[model samples]
Target: MAIYKLDTGWRADYSYYDSFGKRKKKSKRGFKTKRQASEWLTEVIKDINKIKNPYYDWNFVDYFDMNMELKINSGIKSETVNAWQAVRNYIVVKYFSNIKISELTREKYQHFLNEYSIGHTANTVKKRHQILNSVIQQAFHDGIISIDPTYNVRITGTKESKDASEKFLEADELMNLIEHFSQEERLSGNSSLSSFMIVLIAYSGMRAGEALALTKNDINLDHQTISITKTKGRDGINTTPKTKNSVRTIKMPSDFFEIYKLFISHKSEWNKNYELFDGRKIATNPNRTLERYEQKNNFNNIVSIHGLRHSHASYLLSKGINIAYISKRLGHANISITQSIYVHLLNEQAITEEQKTIEMLNGIK
Candidate 1:
């Protein structure tokens, strides 16, 4: 290894023999100081020695593939595995396909993230970064690299974050929506499965996929509860819930169960495996159904099917429901996840309670 001074900066160069006894050379340049170059070269040498087979030249893409295989073998959900594959194909490969794991620097990784954030939302960019960072972290742990390129990297995106209000309906609006759907189901003699689904999601706070995956056996009329054990993926295939916490039983309104009994009575032929919504009737874009309802009712706030889940949580929060209970009811992995998503609603509730506390204190005087 050698550090040499250049016209503007210093450079570190190294030569070594691989595990196969083949000679190879690597170098990095443009460091401001000789010490910086020496330190980097030392890290590289240490990393090389740590690897059992330094002969294997694995690129970032190669590490990503291995990470994906490990994740699959570890029993990650198919949807999650598919998402990681998409990130690899569309983002990671597009930028870092040829970059060797040892060659990845913080600056280079930051540049790739800056490019990716150009037309994406902050959340979208953050999620993609997390996926890539996981693979890079594994490479570091496996002694393929000395440092995590993702560490302390600032994540930014040009696209504006979505407004929270637009993601859910207020209590009155949600009640009106449910009432409208309920009337539609009754008038149609329980034939409108979409309308029924909208009502179920609004009341139960179940994700659209979880609601769709429900079977006749999952509903308990006597107990006034519904079991959430699985979800329907975007591919129309049934799979386990998103997390272990998602496998839960939640209470439903007795009146809602009455409507359910009426609805189920019309479907006597449905077997235990038969899904709540007919596969043929499940729209590729569920938001279209919400749009139709909004137009018919002249609703000012338009929300997607997933928005009904948000609306459900918002409604419960507005009514002073315990957030921890709400988290479990919504099948969130933890209360923190629920709090982050509905922090705005929680803030509003906090203000109301603060006012009540001040008023009670004043009355004591």
Candidate 2:
């Protein structure tokens, strides 16, 4: 006899014959009510009585027939699966790990979401909601649950705009920042390092991650160009750029090539001790370096290392660089996105040009 417990506080008791024809009784635990126990009893009896049926096809049954732990082992990646494991550790162990898959409803998910609001930001809440929804969907697909519980639960959070996430330094502010950054770097015995990174992002318009991921091999000082092969995207995949257009090479500053060479030589010398920073492997967490620099310098407008990318694009506009060139240099997925965000600044520059034309025409008359 084998007895198993279902999540709905039900016990399934049964007896089975072993391979050697020995009778065995196994009892599964975790029953809270007689009705729940009776439900499992009925289901178990059917399985036990049908053992002689040749076409039983137990494998065809969904994961509900098995255990939650076994079903989680089925098809998702370890990282993704770990998210559900955390939820299980938090909710299931705290409340009811043995609750029936069919009984866990949307109301329960809503409650979890409501409780989550007090401590988590909307983005964090959304991520947790997504993790829960994924688990529910998997369970439904695997036949563990009759319905997906997370479908109706709403995440109460507004999505932040891509542009809103950034706060770029204006031209004068950027110059001041560079002056401060350079002075701090000089005092630290790494005079050119921080300035070179700033120049690379500002001039090339590369994402902070792609810039940080750079190694000495990725640069071509002789050719005066940089090959950007990878970009950080959602899911943390180290694949191609955001768009196909982003794969193009960037022309380096003619004078800056020598500076890059000098920086590489210094990094290479230090690489003898640290394997990761050996000029061959990717540069590690450049933003942390930027953060320390920002803290030391204490600029009024606090911004992330990523904001340097935006500042670069903004600087290009200020330099009278064509919009198309700026768009391509920034590796914008769409020209429309670049134009829409930067058109107002371009228009302001256009007003100055219009005034110059008027003055020239008036002088000629």
Candidate 3:
């Protein structure tokens, strides 16, 4: 193997002699660094050893399939594996199916990004970039590529806002929603109550998946705290919570105990858990039910069911509660997440507190 620097970047050359003493040489150029050139040489040597390997001269799609198999067998969440598969399908089928990973270039990848981003949102592009970057990095790690094609590529796509959503119910509005839920539960006469799930999540700040993962024994009426050991994925598979913090117990309001008891009584005789809240195998579907309530009650601030957790945090923040406490209660890994989300509400509190201070100073004057 021989390496040389060129005005373009770096080049690598290799040679082998036949029995007849004839020289057979191969050379490749356009590597960004001498180290990259060396890495490519290593990949070439490995490919020469594995003449019959399917992935020996594979494209990005082939490499992606190989790496993803390892990723799946390595025991990541199935949902995460599914998401990665989705990214692979979108990229391979749409644009990069034929491009060999060894031949993939930064310029070509930039072009791919530009073309792939045409109709997608910035957030969508960002997510795809994350997955693609990982896939390409894996190829580089395996010495299949010298440079990561995804490197230095500018992101394109309409990015979503980082601000916390304001579409959540006020405290009084939540109570009104609970009342509506009660009505629905009574009229159905089936013990399966959609409102129970909502009320459980709203007051306890458990995620939709976390609440769905709860069993009858997970609730402690005497202690007024619900344990959140696991969470269900969107695919209805049981998995660990979002983070270690999310796996902690959440203290429930006293009002939640009776609701829990009532719902637990409704579980099918043969079933282990109350997974039939809306008369289905899954837990709850709040959209249609809440939509009807909002129309009939003339409620203006109708929040999504997930919005209940936001509303809970917003309400507590509005009441001058500690941010760290709120963060832990919501199972956020740290207080900063809570602070970022409720910054707008916190700013309002500052204004109110400042006004109160001025009023007190005026009395002193």
Candidate 4:
């Protein structure tokens, strides 16, 4: 091990041989003191030794905890790690608390999944299976198990899928909801940040987190564009968006800027660096507020705040917008993702186009 002092801070570098007798080097920098650097290097060496001699007779739960620690150290996103932890706590641990990793078999795994699917939705069951399968595959790679038990396992869930109406509002309904929020903001004298947020989501189709993380600098009133550069993760504001495609700028409707101008006019002076919405104020279950609006208004269909994004996409589809353009506007990683999510709306559009094609062919004669 070697510790060197730089102009900014101290750095620690170490080299060791792994279990396969291959030499590997590790280095870390930006420590305030040489002592801190030395201590970090020592911890890294200890962790390497522990990995080289992991407990051979560990149960599934025990191994899962260890794997999560390794993943956290390897810099996995906190939100993703938290989701994996949830699956482990709520599903995997309940099913395999006493099962040894090596003793797990295809039959036992399938039985566990079958029981988990008893009352759960298909999407829920699939998510649990995906998380657990990843863990099991990692164990196989580490030689903890000779074969992956989840290789050909079947997943089954009994619950029916949610109706599309429940997932998104119709175009007219969405417009009504937007108008309702706009009127509420007008009546409340622009004191309702949540109201503004709802309208913004309806207009721009940004994720709730992405909208929450927005700042004055992200919006260009002159250009009528909003740049999506970051998101609100579990650990407050993250500097990266959910995906690479989510970093694009979207053109907002001309009317949206009018609403934005009114929304900003009511606020007192604030730094451009500060988030537009107070993070603490809107973080406490904005969905409940949306539900209240739905109940108060006589709308037959209601959706969550995320449903606003869906509603935006559905409204665009209704206006005969191209799916590829919609995909980029929504910042989807690929067009296929947009296609899958809005497949129902796309099917409706397809039927409409087919009829128009038939009418045009008949008119040609």
Candidate 5:
């Protein structure tokens, strides 16, 4: 090993014998100092040694960890990283943890896919498959693997994959939720805060992340508008809205705005930078609050907190409102996304119009 000082920076060089007894040389440039170059080169040499030594059997599980390290270092969205992490855990713990990467045969990978198909839906399996394929393809490109195991893998979808789009709140359901909660929330002082949040979320179509990241100053009770400039990520960290369209101003109804005013009555709760529900942790999950509402009222559908946003959108669509206005209200990046999710509802509207056209024709006849 040697480190050479140059006009621009230092260069590190290391040489070793390949598995075939051929001399192999490797070098890296742009290191700031001799010490830095030496250290980086030393690590590279050690890694190369590990890759070639007959006794050192590297597995895909460990390789994936190193691959993920690069992803984390590159400042990827925490939510996306978290999703890949679940896939990584499933791979490492469920299968292939002990199998050597070089020993991974196409037959063995096919067997693993068969096992994976037993439990997960087709869409679910496909997601995991996509992640694995990416890593395996990378390994192949890096010359670490002889062939890509998933090269010919085909994904077959299931009936579960074709399940109808998400469930949303109907007008009746929203009203029931609000009425039930308005009474129940008044009974429990903590309920009032979550109650307002439910109404705001249902009416405004704000994401759970945007709702959680709501600050006291973001709300204008007098103007009946709430500004959505930031959102909470899956990692529970507050960050700017994921998309530019996510930053929006949503107008609230008078009664709904009044609910917010009533909750912030106390001087301690009126903090500018503090969260709307500053002292209360009940708003953390809101599921418990919803559970309480369900238990007390015995509701038919189990709508999630996020479903309120869906409900709000569906409710607006039923009124024959402009899709563009709804898109902006929902803070969707484009109207196409709104149309895609609400296509079923749009079909229902078409059916209603068809019925009217048939009636008009019948009356003329």
Candidate 6:
């Protein structure tokens, strides 16, 4: 028997027997008028009676996979898809595959974090929690869940910003790396291309993948400028630059131009069987080449191939390039990123200016 109550307001409670013949009670909230209560009761009863859910009825996994595939098909970058997949994999493997979206609770999430992310940085755990919360939100939007289950969850750990531990290569380090590239006696036979790749990555402020994804067509030997058509971003699309400003071309210095030409010529002559680096025509993996080069060269440092990109930004800031220009050149989605990472550099300039002003005041006083 179902119960009806008008204790606070008119309301109807419905009960039904589940598959195991266990009685389940359901109620509706916010039905003030009796007519509204009656309508809501009828709808709720129909819904409760119609649902025949099987065990392990999670569709979010399939939905997420489909959404990721759609993005990849639409020309998003692989790294973006990889990050999302990482989030999904963690949820499935750590939380169990059968965990339903509706069953997610703050306590369970807290427990998961405590167990799996022990000794990991707060930032890492926060990112994982954020991803899971994002999936739950999507489920809500899709009507597969009633509410976002991960809401109001506390993140106990804090993480530094992306550039927290980052420091630019000193001038000596930069020169050493350059000299290392030039020393043929010290290099393995394959070091020449690897050297060029690293130097170009550092000098041009191009992402490693973007540098690797470059086509011969993107490089203008005569004009000494490079066009960056695509880059890897958080969302993983391979379309235009991260921002509209990032889509602009940058001219190389004369010295760089000469080396550029020499490398281009060497690449052209050395490997006639070597195909041009066209994404559409020659779809080789840049990471494979980078890995082999790293293994062969034994270039160990505080950075990776991607670190060259960071080095470029830091070097540009050190040389007094406006943040806006650096931001555009590096394809940063916003000037805020450029400023945030390079804030110390900007502060140093300001301090110098302040010191100069103080000196001038002393002289006058």
> Candidate 3's residue-wise lDDT over 157-197, tens digit each?
65444345446777788777766565435434542455676
Query: Where does candidate 6 clash, by residue pair?
Result: 76-237, 77-236, 77-237
- CA RMSD per model (angstroms): 5.5, 10.4, 6.4, 14.7, 11.6, 7.7
Q: Tell me the deviation in Å of residue 54 in model 5.
A: 12
Please list the C-alpha lDDT of all candidates, in the order they appear.
0.82, 0.61, 0.73, 0.82, 0.75, 0.62
TM per candidate: 0.79, 0.57, 0.77, 0.80, 0.74, 0.71
Across residues 104-184, which tens digit of lDDT does each residue of candidate 1 receive? 889999999889899899899999988888888877786666677888999999999778877898788898887877773
Better of 3 and 5 by lDDT: 5
Worst 10 residues of 2 by lDDT: 55-64
Candidate 2 at residue 185, lDDT? Answer: 41
For candidate 5, give the lDDT.
Answer: 0.75
Model 5 Cα lDDT, one tens digit per residue, 1-365: 78899999999888877779899899888988888997898678657856775323567788777778887798877666877799888765578888876667788888887777875688887888887777777776765655678878766544364323446755787888776655534624746667667766876788877887788788886788999998766666667887899999988888776556655663244444587654332246576676567557666556777767777888898998888999999999999999998899989988998999999999994
lDDT measured at residue 208 in model 4 versus the true structure, 0 to 100: 85
**Candidate 3's error at 197, in angstroms?**
1.7
Clashes of each: 0, 14, 2, 0, 0, 3
Lowest-sum lDDT 10-residue window in model 1: 278-287
- For model 5, the run of ten residues with the poorest summed lDDT: 157-166
Q: Provide the lDDT at 245 for model 5.
A: 96
Instruction: Name model 2 segments beyond 4 Å from true.
Output: 1-103, 157-166, 180-195, 231-245, 268-289, 292-298, 317-327, 336-365
List model 4 lDDT by residue over 292-360, tens digit each.
Answer: 878787667778888889999998999998899999988899999999998888888899999999999
Summarize candidate 2's per-residue lDDT along 86-159 as a digit string, tens digits: 65566545544545454567787677677766655677778766655655676667554445777757776444
